[model samples]
Target: MLFKKTATFITAIMLSFAALFTPFPSHAEAHATNSYQSLENTINAILSDASIKSAMTSVTVRKASTGEIVYEANADRKVTPASTLKLLTAAAALETLGEDYRFTTDVLTDGTISNGVLNGNLYLRGQGDPTLMKKELDQFAATLSKLGVKKINGDLVGDDQWFDNIRLSPSIDKSDETYYYAAQISALTLSPNADYDAGTVIVDAKPTKKGYKPKISVTPDEGIVTIVNKANTVAKGKRNTLSIKRQHGTNKIMVSGNIPVGSSKREWVTVSNPTAHTLAIFKSSLSSKGIKFSSTSKNVRRQAPDTAKVLAVHKSMPLKNLMIPFMKLSNNTHAEILAKTMGKKVYGEGSWNAGLRVMHEYATSIGLDASEWHFEDASGMSHKNKVSSAQLTELLLLVRNAPWYGSFVKSLPISGIDNRFVGGTLRNRLASPSVKGKVIAKTGSLNNVKSLAGYAETKSGETLVFTILTQDHKDSTLPSIDKIATAITTTPIY
Candidate 1:
């Protein structure tokens, strides 16, 4: 009996040792391992396609709920991010400026009203309100008229010193200056429409008849730009190859090309000087409102005096509302304006340098190493801007818990949606049934670069944050990129 007991004890000790040395995976661990392998196979197969085979590509995917990275391909390699850099700008803006911040434009006077005549300068001070429209100026003029000021004996001064006098970003190509997307940035500016395309005017060309000059018109008709119509109307079925270009450093828009007899063409041209443009429109509005300027009144650009009293003020929609257009349309002017505004608010200086410093600091506070990336301009218009896919995915993951995350995510362009404001740039792309409405991301394109980065809902109900950055390809790589996103959305994560 004693011998049998000793043998049993030895057997039990051996069994315990065997269990410790060779353990079985729990159900959760097995699922995660299989999921990781499946995701890798799927993404790798998509990346091998001929469309993006020659291009430099970087991809990164992470679980939204937890910070665990599920897949990555050269994710640490830094490359130009194009407009995807807007993701960083959007997050930093929301975190620093808050969702309720509003830009303000004010009309102030240094002189007292006496018998319907003001003896001092009527100052128009702008604090970077890009949504200022012609109607707003008309309203300003009407306010002055209602206040019983029929004439001003002083100059109509424009105070655009709220931001620096730099009109265009240093990284903008010379050829792009005449286009609306590269519109000048100023504290005072005007947008012709509700799209809030500030510092630009709409040039509409309606074909009058064949073999004749097309009828051309500029919106607002404020005389801020000179129209040099050089286009002619062609036969009804002829190719409508109309071209509109603004001269360098001037508002002389040169319209050239052929338009079908019945077809119309429109282009958004950037103005030469935004501050001057705003002043001219305001002057026109004053005249329309029957508020006349005295013979001695001179229209000029000057700062508002310290003694000036506010006569009228217009506050822009909160930053939350502005994000819809800024992110949806990828407005470069708005991004830069917000950058300078952040700088001015945080460091008392409204300059790109100051604003970028603020952004860099915010990035560091959120676990990003500032030294790993470089951004010359907030809008990613600069070719010098470089960042890694991993960095962008990390940013998306970290900001998920922010108080303003809802507003930030809502601003992203949704895939397969038809509404201009709702689907944004991604409306026509990624329309596959399984992927449609499953991806919300930002689309980016520069000369030879294209990128897509945002969130995707997987088949297993897991939210994935992904970034795909591609550059240096001769052909279009968007198809392959979209395929990758589709795979991410359809692949089971569990």
Candidate 2:
């Protein structure tokens, strides 16, 4: 159901001394006026545009220092927040796991090494580390090589018991199975690149001689995926339309379409079975080290026997360092991995329900009203998630004073920045001289939902925490949203 709340204005507020640097008239003279009507008018005018006539929007702005409600409209209503929900997840992770936490991937064996002919299963275990790459797994193989005994007489096993078997959320669309952004989660998984996109691979198609089939390759060059090429090379001036997709429930990727003779294209496709993907990569890495195992006959799930010996382990970068790519790029896999890790840490289980419970408990402890929000998954990919603007702003205010605030804020994508590492999704947004570098917020977008929430530093140097969510808007609502953000920064202090 759609809902809206009339704008609320809190008056008789003492002017903040930080207003000295404000671009408006002198602070004292502006204080004499004692009203935020102009700012409200500017924001309202943008919202009243014909493009959002039927859209439901909620906005709330509060003084970061005093928690004063500077302006609010429908702030109490619940709305889908898209990726902006990462703000809450990131904060919860920092608080629950601490900034120094790390994820570890280990290699072990159930049998002893003897005379180069040990006869037992070699198990690869994971702790839901999203950043596991081929290089790290190769290091494990190298360590095994240095251990002196190398012939395995049993099937290679993958142990993913750290988390439940449910790899993908039930609510996620089945059609998205091939998209890397909606990759499956596993305690043991392979990321295609350093971006840490777990459970996915990069498919590269390059044009060959005209009239010949295009050459196809997959990154990390693992034999895990089966590529079926139906693509053709066309004349240099022909259209370069191409389509790459993984068949449902399998790792059979179909590459089709025309590629101009000199062109090349790439697609990041999700792997159907994350465990198998990890095992394959590890096996490949092992063979590269001249270490050969007895059989590729069977790859199954099993626990590392108590007698198993530790071979080698790879520890991920600290959680604080991971926050940059996770938050900056809005990585869904990282979010899910951290959620399960939290569950494992707090409840001895690594399921979403248990992890979300920990996050919920943390939220309540921090003073957010329970009725104001609900978390369906750590990542905001699920549409079932809902949160009120007031809840977001309040949470923002609370975290600003937390011990981990420094790392958390640095993780956020900054505005007006062109570098992907710096600007993230907001790099090109809000670039106006007055707004650029002045606002640091998270951006969320889905079918018809758009949300922006975070802190904005005004010309007066007053820090304001705000959230703006628009639902059911068909037309591009970013400009209007940008206007609202700009309004908050330029709004005179009265």
Candidate 3:
């Protein structure tokens, strides 16, 4: 009887020790485990889709409040991020340039005005404002008109020295040059519309009577680009094979092929030299304002003199407001312009090298390992840009506490929202009842590459940060990606 009592006592001590080492999970921990497991299962099922099987995909999801990773799949594998890289660019810009920053275009004159005539050169100096429109140019002309500038005896000079002379990123594909998204970067540039596609013009080809040439018109036609119309308006129901191309190294745009009688086509065609284009438009605005230039006055590209007088200045909308169109429309030109602006702000040189250095510094400050990734251009137009999903999620988490976080979040595309500024690239995606309005993200695509990254609000009222990067897929994987995001939103995490 004594021996039996001793054995029981020893067993009780052993049980106590075991319990100390392996205590039961707390309520919060238990909930987290179940939530993570559920998310993993849901995401894995979507990733197993046949369409995504051939693609190299990476995914990472984290709890925003705790930075706890909920799920990851090949998260460390580096792949081209496509336009999702804009997320990094956007954050870096907000941090480096601040939300209240504004880009400015200034009108300066080297000569004195007397009796309503400028005695010397009239200068338009651009400081990398991508939002400069014809209306703003008209305003500049009006300001000059108010300043008694009636005629110019010297040259009308364009000063784009704020940035380097390199018009296109070295890593850009040659085929993308004619498109507005690949428009050349210039400190002095112009946009045709409120969408603010700088360095390009809007070409509209409306079909006229059947078998006749379609009426071709260019918006804000400042005579910088010459249009060659070779397209014909075919009978109704005919195939519209119309094509518009701007020849390489020239401002000549060729429009060819047939359009159906009722069909009209519009294209945003990039100009060869944006600085010269701005000069032409400004001259036109000046003419409209009744400001005359002598026949001997030339249009030239030169730096403004230090002693030049500031006649007028046009300030862009704050960086916070600019973020709406920039992130919503995935504006590549805006990304590049911001990058160069950062370089100019920090290193006193507006070159990609300087700008990327600032971006790298900002990334490192946000706990991202800058050495692990490569980005040749601020805009992900270059396929050389590479980033892992894990790194992107890390970035997304750290930026949550930023002062500009609200602006940043507001800039992302909301799923199922039809408004272009609100829905952006995600307008028609993930529109099912369970997922609509739950996912806010950036959508990315390139040849054989796709990505989506941002935040998802779960049913449990938790915000989850996620990044999905896919590359080299033969088929479209956007549907599968959307399903994965939907799963994240609907899965019970609590």
Candidate 4:
């Protein structure tokens, strides 16, 4: 089946070349009038702006149906892709796991249940489902209650062996441990809310009495997180500034700042130990359901015993359903989870090294030259990752023929759309009516890197795939990138 599809793709590419070299009468006339040359000059003017003269820029546009290059400028020069790398990860996931793949979280026990007591330890085994919620944990607790297990004689163990023990990527910035974007990745993790942000919690600070310390609270209120508040509420109109940080090697969050009277501040902070946080939340949920544990919960690195019996289970929505949030919000955790999961599924080892190997193999098999791109991490958060505009466009064209292509494209952020989740990272971008809703792409941004890549509908009703990567520019280059997209989307029929 794979070979048959590959042949089809190869044949399509050949046909595109045949058409490009054999121009129609009208196209010949347009060439005589220098239409293509005129467009090239216009695009080159934008790319050569003085502000971005020193930066590395890679741009490529190709006709989706024909696989013919329409425009190119340093397209083969490698540049950091940032979040746009998610496109590669997402495509690999669809191929490896399929659209119907689902993750399951299970409750198991190694002890026998007699009368109203469980004589041994209760194990919570996680399958690395990123969408697990407090409500689902509540359901697990309810199940225990229904089973008449009121007490656990042994420890409440959190089994996170589904993946390796590594939590945060070493390449990520280590100074700010509280930033939710850099949250830890764990097999057993908990997201505070529907944003599906795992390994983090929300901290809200509100003023209490004038000249006194402000009160702090965390949402979903079940996880165990300690907040050391040293903030004060000052007189009205006073400057409001707040600082929130999680101490190294512990789950202690320090919040120090001043908020004017009647003002409130909020932030989403990462948790130091996500396994402990999950266990804490589960234990609390069990307590609310009238269940108790004799000892504190602990992390269990090993797999559950064979003698263990199943108590309750929760399965996540299919992979196809998750693509929307995963891609729309540019969720780093999702990318990492999928990468590790792919590694585990294909090689029986759930590490980044193993997963990235599979990703490279897949990309190469689909016509993207392996030498043209290098990926260090699935989320593109690593500065070591590099890919050329030509490679990204080749990937886009190859995947357009895949069975899951529609869902994959829909997962991208649409340009000019006003909807938050729908518009995603591109919601406010390309707002001009001429371009709005005409382009769908993935966005990438780092300290001084910006990238956008995906599909654009040209005025002639042809679909074009494009990629724009700009790095180390001192000024904003988004406007220039937008103009490039506009040209591709508005390309004349000829």
Candidate 5:
């Protein structure tokens, strides 16, 4: 039986790879066996198990220094790449924009400030900084207070020209409004993954005088949503729904629900309406600051006149640290915004559509065959992107040699524990028992789809680049996150 196969087109596509890497030695006895055949057999065993029949798997393992494919299974079957796409984005960014790139947000006053009032318009301009919210914005507002300006004489505007335009993915439907997938990226998304602008209710269940009824405040980000909290804490580990709804263009936030008193302020995990929540927080913050202005916020249509007086300026957290957390934690919003930032740097706009084209072009120039790969969005939130396992492995191999490898490795999580952070990765079990901590890659999961790609250094002094992508719908039984992870960790490639 054909355990692994590749089309002529794929081999021809790989011919281009010759310019990128040299072939590996056939007898690097340091691996699990003397040659690639034994490794191939092991991979076949793993892929052929009856339990794996339902999975749609495509994989490729290559000696990193020599690009020699040790084992492969459906290496050319195109499938969803998920967040692994971040690697390409990260690569393009590292090569074209350099690792020290930073996104900036500037505050400008169309007029001058005097006697606690801005004589002209107040403009909040952004260059698509994803981390501009709450604390950052609060600090910005505070600086204006010190400048002897308690009020704005004109409109409080939002200048987001860094992005050509912003819109939601048409792939999502109306029901997805509250889901993160339906979020609309802005030049000023503020918190990563749309955290703060996603509406937060200060659950004041602290034994109030009103017989313990929770006090919910209306601070919708987009200003038109209602939060219905059906959550009431009963015991430890008890969970309920924190639902939110809204009509377009309204500032009224209605929250009704029961919450268990944790004896502390708790952030219950729940979906949020990002757009409405952002607008709400902005309104609330401005109101509390006594910056008297109408509820109406006009999008700054043109650049704040260069002659515009300078009142205040705000900066986001450093990009270096942000990139690690975004990649290691697999932050969808941050990844999307990062790609958008690339678009802005390259073409002066942050549209995902534009950024995506940029990513593909970069990959092609790096030796990937355009006919063998496809991409839709940088975030991988959409189900439209596709790429083969062999190609993925090849890409990772290139990234391994890139100058930004350290920052790249720091982006993936570790194994065994940790839900969405710290501990969720495949260990270096098979390659080198002591070769742990050397493999750093991204893990992806969407419905029946699963993917793992990264670099591995073996005890035999060999470094390997690998990618395993599985799609199982019928008899698809996942190997408990830990076991599947172990398989990757334990691969004896070192």
Candidate 6:
């Protein structure tokens, strides 16, 4: 109900602003009476309108075909791109790695195998593919079982050296530990959150007179170190604090939350170590299927000196499908991994800076003026990032002509109803009758900044590129700022 109320309230505000541009007052004597004559003029007029003028910090619009400027309001100023920065990563990936690219991870056994028993350690290695998950890990284990690997008397080796070592949450504020966003980014993150792994929780609990507590078990895979706590849910519509801790070799997640009487409830909480925990679960599952390991797995420091050689490789979904999730969800992990993977595929090791260098070079080669854009991370999770509206539009323009444009652009979230854009007017309006299927753009937002950049097709089928960036706008003023962006795109021009 709270979420719904918030959504409704925001919608009302947006609609109110949407009504402002319906009919600009034409009778003001000494007003900023700017005639809506040409596309550029109308764009400028709407941008300058008092209703939204205060919220806007900068904006830019351009034609894709001739590289002509259609509108500009502080177009050259620098501002944070937020998640919209994924566009650059995606574009660079398309040009350097192509659309058919894929990320691969492998599992190898180091000790010689005799019959159903392995004489050595089992190795879990990642090839910089960001999509590595539990399901994928499970499949590999299933394969190991078929090879008659009943037991391994050695440690499970986890290797993430395929890419340069990196930690998660380099920029997260420590005070915000309550959020998953605060967790650092890492090449080898095993269940960073002890109780949950990337939103995956194992629920095991039984109902009691006081609450569900006795025999409730929510233990993560053994490889993960756990932290336990006790949470009590008093009533409906509230979350309880369950006892959660990882001591020795176990993570116990006990819940004392309220539930409907006679109700069987289960849910997957976001498990933090998602990557490592996933591998741990896969190993355990494989063990259940006639495979056994007599020793706990250890994080391997370097490549195994004499490890089981890999005979086959399983590639993940094509870059196209993956990028879709990356763009639609604006996943920081996915974007970073893709950038690093692209760099590794081209220059090896997939260093963030290496891939960034490659991306900047490619952007320049494509004739996009990247003079003002500088990136420290592929995913624009940090405020240190900088970009210009013109550069963003130029990126869209470059993506339109690139060979991998189809997958890269198609992956971008549409205006109205994707993961984040659900019921949004600024983006959704692009799918409305006035601009239906005419624009494909990405939106960016920070504390006081909002931006939209992408391509639109004219009624004549010509592609148009535009980018709008508004920084330091007050919260109460965002509605008008959003309206200004919509007005520029949807405001009818004679």
lDDT of 2 by residue, 59-129 (tens): 98776656777778888888898888888889889999999999888988877788776577889999988
- How do the residues 1-494 of candidate 4 rate in per-residue lDDT, one tens digit apiece? 01122565445434433332332121110112244554577679888888666789998877665666777889889999999999999999999989999988999998888888998888888878989989999999999999998988888888888889888776687775678778888899988888888888888888887899888889668676888888888888889987778887788788887888878888888888788889888989999988877765454446788788998999999998889889999999999999999999999988888888889988988777987778888998987889999889888878876888767876888787666566789989987867776778999988888899998877766677789998988887788888888887675756
What lDDT does candidate 6 reach at residue 405?
69
Candidate 6: minimum summed lDDT over ten consecutive residues — where? 24-33
Residue 416 lDDT in candidate 4: 72
| TM-score for each predicted model, relative to the true structure | 0.92, 0.91, 0.93, 0.91, 0.77, 0.76
Per-candidate Cα lDDT values, in order, are 0.85, 0.81, 0.87, 0.82, 0.57, 0.58
- lDDT computed for candidate 6: 0.58
What's the C-alpha lDDT at position 434 in model 5? Answer: 35
The full ranking of all candidates by lDDT, starting with the best, is 3, 1, 4, 2, 6, 5
Q: Per-residue error at 474 for model 6, in Å?
A: 2.9
- What is candidate 1's lDDT per residue for 238-340, written digit by digit as tens? 9988999999988899999999987898899999888888999999999887788988787799899888999999999999999999998888889999998
Q: Write the per-residue lDDT of candidate 6 for residues 212-268, one digit (tens) a residue.
A: 333444544454534342433344444443433222122333344354333344444
Clashes of 4: 0
Off by over 4 Å in 5: 1-36, 192-226, 229-303, 417-438, 459-461, 474-494
Best by lDDT: 3
Between the candidate structures 3 and 6, which one is better when assessed by TM-score?
3
Root-mean-square deviation (CA) per prediction: 13.0, 7.6, 12.6, 7.2, 9.1, 8.6
lDDT (tens digit, per residue) of candidate 3 on 152-230: 9899999999999998887767788899999999999999898899999999999999879999999888758999998
Misplaced by over 4 Å in model 1 are 1-32
lDDT of 5 by residue, 130-185 (tens): 56656666666677777877766676666666766655544445554444444556
lDDT of 2: 0.81
